[model samples]
Target: MSGLLALLDDVAAIAKVAAASVDDIAAAAAKAGAKAAGVVIDDAAVTPKYVHGFEADRELPIIWRISLGSLKNKLIILLPGLLALDYFAPWVITPLLMLGGAYLCFEGAEKVVHAFAPHADHEIEEDFDTKDPAHLEEEKVAGAIKTDFILSAEIMTIALDTIDSPNFWMQAITLAVVGIFITVAVYGAVALIVKMDDVGLHIAATGRTSGGRALGRGLVLAMPKLMAFLSIVGTAAMLWVGGSIVLHGLEDTHLWAWPYETIKHIAETTAYAMPVAQGFVKWLVAAAIDGVFGLILGVLLIPVATRVIGPLWATMTGKKAGPDGHPG
Candidate 1:
């Protein structure tokens, strides 16, 4: 009887420990997901473009395929690789993260330039290459998946850097949670963005009340502007976050201190000026500074990439630069 009681107590204690571990994982995953927000936002923003011009019925399927691809990218591929890095070469994370940040900066800067100076659209080239809808869909999905892999690599790596778990299994579980959450959040948003027009049209046509119809019509009209806004916001996020990462990485490496320190000082001063919402104001100031720096660096990279890297890549791959001034 005493032995049975002791066994019961032991089981209860184990349950408590398991529950605590679960809570820890949830907390860690949330924190890590938050850290990867900038990349996630860009992922969501970029994915919708892949479904553009597809029939309404086909949009969800494309998003589904891409979401699956993103999951595979994060979970099956990058997860193990990152875990190996964490175990063997933890020092390498900062440099790889900074490399990702530089690429983000370059991408953001290119978009800023393209926004000011619109060129021949990539869609046009894509359209020219594939006349069949099914083939085009396949190509777009494939391209989007490829892009997702890169973005997912960045996201997962950033998340891994943020994870504080000492246990390997705990870290793995948290990363898996982050990966699943990100895939759902990003692609779910994309699905909504892509389907918004159809949804609006349905509501507009089928709504019993005039107000409902009006709301639906408004939604339909607003989608294009919304998409444009998302693109702009995503680009800004990429620049700001990318620049911040690079600065932080440099700071970590004991390379560049002034940029981050100066940015912090400026942000603090700005925060001090605004007594209310001081935290928010400071963060905004820092982000803006980082964004500006990213834009500058990204702009500088554009010419170098185009004049040198693009041509070298083309020569090596036997491919030409795409309409977006990038080697495909």
Candidate 2:
């Protein structure tokens, strides 16, 4: 009986340790997810565009397909790649992050340029429209998954960087949690965004109360504006986050510190004047500066890419130039 009691005590102690480890993992995952917020926001913002122009019934289905692809991208592909990279080629992380950031900047800047130019890429938009619906859906889903892979890579790297886990198991657990949490948060928001119009239309058409109908009308009317707002916000976020990442990477790799430090100092100095609004002002200025830098870098890269990298890529892939005819 005494021996049985001792064994029970040991089991209880083991249970306590397991519980504590779980708590630690949860805490770490939350922190890591928070650290990847910029990338996550961009992910949520970018997804809704792929579902645009689809029939109402098809919208949710498209979103669901993309969401599943996103999960597979993160869990099955990216998770293992991250682990292997960490174990083998850890040195590539920062460079790959910078490359991803550059891509984000390029995308954001291309949108800005198109807005100003207006006639820049009508052919590409027309191509998107001309494709068979089924084929287009497949293409969009594939494109979205590809984009998600880049963002997910950034998020995972950021999460991994933020974790203070000492052991491989702990790091793996935290990353897994972070990946699942972020995928849900991003795709859940995308689903809501995609379905808001349908929900509004249904409510407006069959609501029992006048207020419900009015709310539905408001949702339907507001959705277009909301989508516009999301596009603008997403572009800004991509530039801000991308430029920030590049700046920080440069600083980390010891190439340039003055640009980052200078921006921080100026933002802080500007914010000092506003006691209550200091944090907001600082953040705004920092983002603005980073966005501007991103825009400039992207603009510079465009011609170079077109003249050099684009042709090289086309040649390597044995595809004709101007196949997509898009800036991407």
Candidate 3:
């Protein structure tokens, strides 16, 4: 009986430690996830477009497929890569992060350019209304998954960089939790956002009370504006987060310091000017400065990416396979 009691006590102690560790992991994941909020919001906002023009019945399934792909991208590919980078070449993390940040900036800037120049709804609608629904669905799903992979990579890396774990296992668990939680949160929000119009329609049609019916009608009317607002917000967030990441990376690698320092000092001065709204002022200043930097970098990168990188990618992917067996 005494030996049995000792074994039970040992198990109880182990359980307590495990429980504590779980709490720590959850706390870290939440913190890290918060840091990557911009990318998360952008991911959620962009994903719904994939479901556009699909039959109402098919939207949820399409979102589910994309969500699953996002999960695999984060947990399977990015998680291992992050761990390996942390352990072997910790120095590479900053550069990679900067690269990801640049991508985000480019994405955000492209959206901005599109908004002003306004690509005619020509191609997107054409693709959606394609004769073969099956082929269109496949293409859209593949495109969404590829896009999710890029955003997921950013989210996971941001989470990994933020975590302050003491060991490999803890880091792994924290990142895994972060990845799963973020994926669920993003997709769950997407699902809710996408189906809200249907829900509104149902409520508007079936509600027993007049007030309820009015609310439902209002919801139906409001959804498109809400989606548009979210898109704008998402783009701004991408620029802010992307530019901030690149600035931090530059500081970390000692490539640049004066500009960031100057920004901080200006923010501090601005904070002093608005003592009551100091925190908000500081954040606003920082975000604005970051956004400016992001726009500049993105504009510079646009031409290089279009002219140089695009051609190189086409060549490598054999997208230019020619009849004469020559480069197009």
The true-versus-predicted C-alpha distance at residue 142 of model 2, in Å, is 1.6
lDDT values, one for every candidate: 0.90, 0.83, 0.87
Give lDDT: candidate 2, residue 128.
54
- Per model, state how many residue pairs clash: 0, 0, 0
lDDT of 3 by residue, 1-328 (tens): 9999999999999999999998999899999999999999999889889888889999999999888988999889999999999999998888999999999888888788778886665644543437888888888888888888889889988988998885899999999998999899999999999999999999999999999999899999999999999999899989999999999898888999877888889988999998498999999999999988998887777676767776776689866422212123
Candidate 3 runs further than 4 Å off: 121-129, 320-328
Off by over 4 Å in 2: 120-122, 125-131, 320-328
For model 3, state the Cα shift of residue 61 in Å: 0.7
lDDT of 2 by residue, 55-105 (tens): 888888888888788878878888788778877887787887788788778
Local lDDT at 139 for model 3: 83
Candidate 1: 10-residue stretch with minimal lDDT: 122-131
Of models 1 and 3, which has the larger lDDT?
1
Query: Which residue pairs overlap in candidate 2's backbone?
Result: none
Q: After superposition, how far is residue 204 of candidate 3 from its true place, in Å?
A: 1.2
Per-residue lDDT for 6 in model 2? 100
